[model samples]
Target: MSLHMTGAGALEDPICTYPGSRLPVRAPCARLEGRYLAFLGGSETFGRFVATPFPALLDRRLGQTCVNLGSINAGLDAVLGDAGAMRIAAAAALTVVQLPDAQNLTNGFYRVHPRRNDRFLAACAPLTELYPEVDFTEFHFTRHLLIALHRHCPGRFATLRTELQRIWVTRMHRLLRGLGGRGLLLWLHDGDDSPRSDAPLGSEPLLVSRTMVDRVLRQARGLVEVPVTAAGQLEGETRKMDFGPLQRPTAEHMLGPAMHARIADRLGDAIATLQ
Candidate 1:
């Protein structure tokens, strides 16, 4: 969340994008040298409206450097494609990767911008055939495309959603394997550790089922699932958001300060085990 002044004339500069990466990360990128901790993930890890995201907090608690490599609305594609960022994370003393929503990733039916994972690029033949009546050109974002598809043809959307889950499973397995037991998958949201849901596509991660998490666990060091408690959810209530009018709704869904503390604690525990 970038700083933005309210219409009344209050200055707000919460989120800051550093040099190097196009995405916004915690300002003053921590030193990569030495025994530093590396965190890789999406907006949650970036600490949108929350004053102190988990990475900064964890650094203070551990008396060590923790580099926050999180980007807003990041998907696996964004991190995987970022050679510089991934290179840093892979070499960190300890790495905690936040499991971003699967919806932002590019799959067989569509292509997402490598850096901007949310930006929908092209619709392949498979997607077109599934929704022949829909104009693929009209879609510019993954969320928009999925919503429109679901509305146009629920059955076809269901099938597509299922395929996405499978893709997520396979890709996640490869990601964990690549991390070499260093990757500790972190799941942060309002609900349970598992992804069980009637409408898998209804959420941000798209269709990541519990079974998918279970499968990835084989390669993952462990999955730290932190469901924000009601109290933690209230931290954003009094805080002013960096979002514009159109983005307010979505911003509300972001985890708050209380949740960040919990996440930091979870990571601290994981770090202890690693030591």
Candidate 2:
């Protein structure tokens, strides 16, 4: 659902990077100050098409300085590689981490772009050998590559899925431990509030299962699961989102302003318990 294409540059959010991290985050950058909250994730956490993302809304809701360290298409490597962002998370009162898709990360089967985790840089020997028919060059994004691979060979795709889930768990554990147990896992599910099915190549946060989440929960302070139903997502898609004509399709799949407000409300309550 993430299209990394840009429009006429007519609509852009203020963004900047920290001294030690090259990740582009929402701007009016946060200083390494005292008692601030750090929010980390991909596009949703970055407020891709929304004017005021939940992080900024939380700032007003809680009367605290909330730093938005979100980057579009960011995965485990992107987050872990950004020393500046990690440092901010370490020093924050609490770090809210949105669970990113397992497929976007680099593992034994493939390697993704260092900064743009969504871009498919190259497929490793194992992956190439698994799907010897597919031309790796045909793919530009990880999601596209994964979908094609699954459609080409569902059986073989299972192996890659298992590896991705495992790697995601390990990386998530590393991130949580780095936060000194001050991390809160935010599970942003885009379709039902009930338990997520293990169907391969499913919705966003692709290939990640509830079991994988449970494996990494011990290292986190808690988990906040927010489900945005399909109908709910389409409620005011065009009306509430901010995007140019070229970005319309991508923005439609994104959470709207109403959902962001709901996320802020839920996170505010969770954050209050910690304070």
List all candidate RMSDs to the true structure.
3.4, 3.6
- Evaluate all candidate structures by whole-model CA lDDT and list the values in order: 0.74, 0.84
Clashes of each: 2, 0
The alpha-carbon lDDT assigned to residue 39 of candidate 1 equals: 88
Cα TM-score per model: 0.85, 0.92
Model 2, position 242, has a per-residue lDDT of: 65
- Residue range 1-275, candidate 2, lDDT tens digits: 22333557446656789897899987768666778999999988988778788999999989889999998878889989888789888999899999988888989999998777999999999998999898998899998898788788888988998898889999999999999999999999965423233444776678777888898998998999888643234656568666777766678777788788889999999989988
lDDT of 1 by residue, 101-138 (tens): 67677888989988768899999889888888998898
Q: What would you estimate as the lDDT of candidate 2?
A: 0.84
Weakest 10 consecutive residues of candidate 1 by summed lDDT? 195-204
Once superposed on the true structure, which residue ranges of model 1 sit more than 4 Å away at CA?
1-24, 192-204, 229-236, 240-247
At residue 27, give the lDDT of candidate 1.
Answer: 65
Reference-based TM-score, model 2: 0.92
